[model samples]
Target: MQHDIAYDTAAGSQSITRAIGRVISPIAFLPADAAEFFTPVNTNKNWLSGEGKRLFDLAIALPLLIVLAPLLAAIALAVRLETKGPALFRQTRSGMCGRPFKIFKFRTMTVQEDGASVVQAREADPRVTRLGAFLRRYSLDELPQLLNVILGDMSLVGPRPHAMAHDDFYQSRISEYRHRFAAKPGMTGWAQVNGLRGPTPALEQMTSRVSHDVFYVRRASFSFDLKVLLSTPIEIIRPRNAV
Candidate 1:
């Protein structure tokens, strides 16, 4: 974990399509300073964090669950038949204010490691099943987390949750890491949509992801959440760092 904490502020440049998307989207993808892009701007004490965010979550997740019921059932069945384990995978993850909650996913791995110490999935890992690989690639494994959103243990948009072990490991080394807990964890966030998804074996990489998460925490709003939701499908089709 001994590495420079600095993240490249140069988000460089973006295309015309992305430029237009930046205006409507809350997360930045423009040629502007990425230092500004990742930095948290609003630290005002008066800003209400949970205001309208829950209503937004229910508004979107409820309909999505209804629409994808058949697909969810089919995926569950497929996962069960693919391996001997349960179709759904559950693990303890850090929620708002660092509280612990069991997060759900469609089991895409042959092994369910949920102990105090859990390893992250690497590319071409042998533990992945043929069906599991497809599920992870398209992010179908995350469909079950909509239940978490409904259950109010999570949000439709916020910092992506991490295992307790990961929280323990990085919180000490990274100064601003715990700031992510200011809001509930998310199904997708500013990090994932910007290709910051998946493993962070490198310290600087984790630092960048935390920066993005903190950015969301300071700027969480209906419009920002809407933009993150809109960008999710695009990220799924061309997944960046998902293993």
Candidate 2:
């Protein structure tokens, strides 16, 4: 099999094999001069690596899980009692380098309603249950994805993963869409914080969101991620464009 290497950094350039399997660090990519700016992380599957990312994800997610466990339980019970299906809904989402992983989220609709490219959820969609509507409004429905963050399928802050069907469409419509896979998908992302969540009927909306997603991929860092996470709760409380 052929592996694709997309390296962007001051380290000139070199190719490594999948079998070689070396872990590259942040210092290898960022130069001292541009460290203050949003230094693009090296994200080639080989040239840039996933070792640090996976470790960081686990470190953050485990503590969040332990802290949020009780709240998660209450939300799960609310979802179950308010809806007929399982409390958690799992779907195959595109992850780092386009790998697929089952993303977990609290069920927000009365029905499963997944298939080959379904419609994006809209405000007042009849599929949403009462509690589900509240959950969606406050972004409580997404709490279960902390599990995915812990499992390494996602990060606390990165490009937001789309439904596989949405991925197929956006990958074609937006050139930068595929570039989002350059990093691990996140539970929430740069786009979502800026009112990019909910139904996007226009291609330009997806285009804008994808552009931000790709931008985050090229400019992610520990402090940047922390800022995004810190703002998420406030954003959820007063979501500007939530469905």
Candidate 3:
């Protein structure tokens, strides 16, 4: 019962026609009211919406990718060498307007579980490789998402994306959860920079995280994004709840 994503070890995009017959079709489980959050509540003039945001994303993302190309390649090689699986991991995540897109990361686990019941990695999950732990801790595993940014599937700053399975499970329980989908998911976000990283198994933890996410959705602007970018390095240095 895999939901939106069906991993092809040999990756290729099937037509929208083929996808229906092959992978279990994508579905929209988000509440209709949640769509309202997609528009910022503030009346302030903001360039980080519409075409302006996309341009901003490309401006930052392209240069970062060029500078970090060698390191990204080294990570990919190391991931493949460490595990008997593909170097990259991709899973369908709910994007802006609740559209599903495959989010990419350097594979950090021995298992490639992208199905309905994909499990979150624990603090010392056995699935994580030795190198994988270091990458997750330092957030190196997320570098591939620079490509996501370049491709317009993500942003340089916004709410963090979650597995679609988790989104389906939590959307009903946590009212503010799907509000995070108001904007494109990001490599680093308001919640992540605020020390909300790692697994959120508890109801309270998830709720608190959603609060930050909802705040970002309402208050997003050029300055706010810069603040998240500046604060991210410190969180990387002294990560709270990092696994």
Candidate 4:
């Protein structure tokens, strides 16, 4: 079964509707409290929601988007000149409560795969274009996700959204995996700041990332989100595990 729900965007004047498929029932494994967070009736009353996380997301994202407009345009032009596809890449990513949302990013690969058998990118994957390599290296490709942050499909600080394929694969491997979706996805997350960014080619690596994500869900707060935000620039400038 599938259902469509309207989520508020940063503007708050308009909303975008997304269809969430029932490929994976998050309620089956999510904690009762966590599961309730996604319910329509409980959506606007959660810890993060009630504590002004959405306001914070807009406060930061809106300005960043405006200030970075020129740079974003430059990058978009570069991507277009360097590649033959759209400047932005869109893929379905599992959001809070296992709902799927279309995530936007700067196209960084020759092939855009978003299916059950999507392939994870390796360090020197040939599918990554020359310019794409640089973009991925500095995490420039992820800048477009600020829109997702503004779109209410994500937050400024929360668990990172994995591809639907990765979500399906990992949920089966880790019993508590779905619990990470208790909070909305983020542009930069606890796992990313804690050196868990980039491709998780191994189950162990992914498990470690999931651990941090779940921890953030359990310990999410305004101050903690600020800490993650402050630490993010450092991580971006001096990327560790990022590919």
Q: Which stretches of candidate 2 lie over 4 Å from their true place?
A: 1-50
Candidate with more favorable, higher TM-score: 1 or 4: 4
lDDT of 3 at 17: 27
- Model 4 score (lDDT): 0.79
Cα miss at 43, model 4 (Å)? 16
Question: How do the candidates rank by lDDT, highest first?
Answer: 4, 3, 1, 2
Give Cα-based local distance difference scores for all models: 0.78, 0.71, 0.78, 0.79
* Error in Å for residue 77 of model 3: 1.0
Clashing pairs in 3: none
Per-residue C-alpha lDDT of model 3 across residues 1-243, encoded as one tens digit per residue: 243345542244445424432322223454433344343443432544467777888999899899999999999998888779999999988876577889999999888887699899888899999999999999999999999999888899987888888887887787666557667788898889888889988989889988998888787788888899989999999978877
Which of the predicted structures, 1 or 3, would earn the higher TM-score when compared with the native? 3
The TM-scores, one per candidate, come to 0.80, 0.78, 0.83, 0.83
Q: Highest lDDT, which number?
A: 4
lDDT of 4 by residue, 62-178 (tens): 999999999999999999998799999999987776667899999999999987888988888999999888888888998999999888888888888888888878889976686
Residue 39 lDDT, candidate 4, scale 0-100: 25
Candidate 2, 29-139: lDDT as tens digits: 322222222223443332123466567677878998899999999988887787577999888777765677788888888666455756778878998888888888888
Model 3 is weakest, by summed lDDT over 10 consecutive residues, at 17-26
Better of 1 and 2 by lDDT: 1
